[model samples]
Target: MNRESGRYKGKRIIQGGRTQVRTVLYMAMMSAMQSNPIFKATYQRLLEAGKPKKVAIIACVRKMVVILNSMLRDGTMWDENMAKN
Candidate 1:
């Protein structure tokens, strides 16, 4: 929660999720940023837009999770073009 007019007023990510999953996603995001064209482009765009590196990486990880979930639900193969669209 934000503490208005306090010395500790600042944004923070809620610390309630599974640490193991977060660690795996972070590692996967790092690899994807280097190897996947889609994620690489997104990282580059976020960097150009002045987002913090960690924030950009987390965005990519979230996007990746969404894509993976959709693919699993629909039983579709991974397609670079489809992901772009």
Candidate 2:
């Protein structure tokens, strides 16, 4: 991720992904905040570590995407506690 500093350093907008998938993942991340403990904890931890809000949210998004991909590859259901790593 590329960051720029104008007043505050901020990650640049992510480019070159399918808009449909991006929208779905973003909504999933939002829902995960309310329904998933692991995601919520990761997000809170990142914020407390001084990451920007958007950066923390995106970190959770990436985590969810990776976890989802792993589940699909393994043909297994997600275990809520499995994503801690």
Candidate 3:
């Protein structure tokens, strides 16, 4: 699950990738923070467990990518109950 790494130094979280893809993923993750209860709960749990806000957000985005990949690979639609695991 450790896909992308953002190196932190001073005030920077330096990461290398397509800027557009990163930006889009960030935006989608932000939206999921509000719209998806599972993602929201995971994010809150991460924060409650002492993960940094940015780190938690990135984790959720990674979750999104994994889940989406799974769905496409299995030729199935998203299933909330399935994801609860």
Point out where model 1 deviates above 4 Å.
1-9
List, residue by residue over 7-59, the lDDT tens digit for candidate 3. Answer: 63354464787889988998999999999999999999999999999989999
lDDT per residue for candidate 1 within 1-85, as digits (tens), equals: 3445756667656376798999999999999888899999999999999998888999899899999999999999999987885
Error of 1 at 80 (Å): 0.4
Ranking by TM-score: 1, 3, 2
Clashing pairs in 3: none
Alpha carbon lDDT of residue 22, candidate 2? 83
Q: List the candidate 3 regions with Cα displacement exceeding 4 Å.
A: 1-12
lDDT per residue for candidate 2 within 1-85, as digits (tens), equals 5676677787577888788988888888999888889999999999999998888988999999899899999999988767888
RMSD of each: 2.4, 3.2, 5.2
CA lDDT of each prediction against the hidden true structure: 0.88, 0.88, 0.88
Query: lDDT, candidate 2, residue 83?
Result: 86
Model 3 / residue 51 / CA error / Å: 0.9
Evaluate residue 34 in candidate 1 and report its C-alpha lDDT on the 0 to 100 scale.
Answer: 88
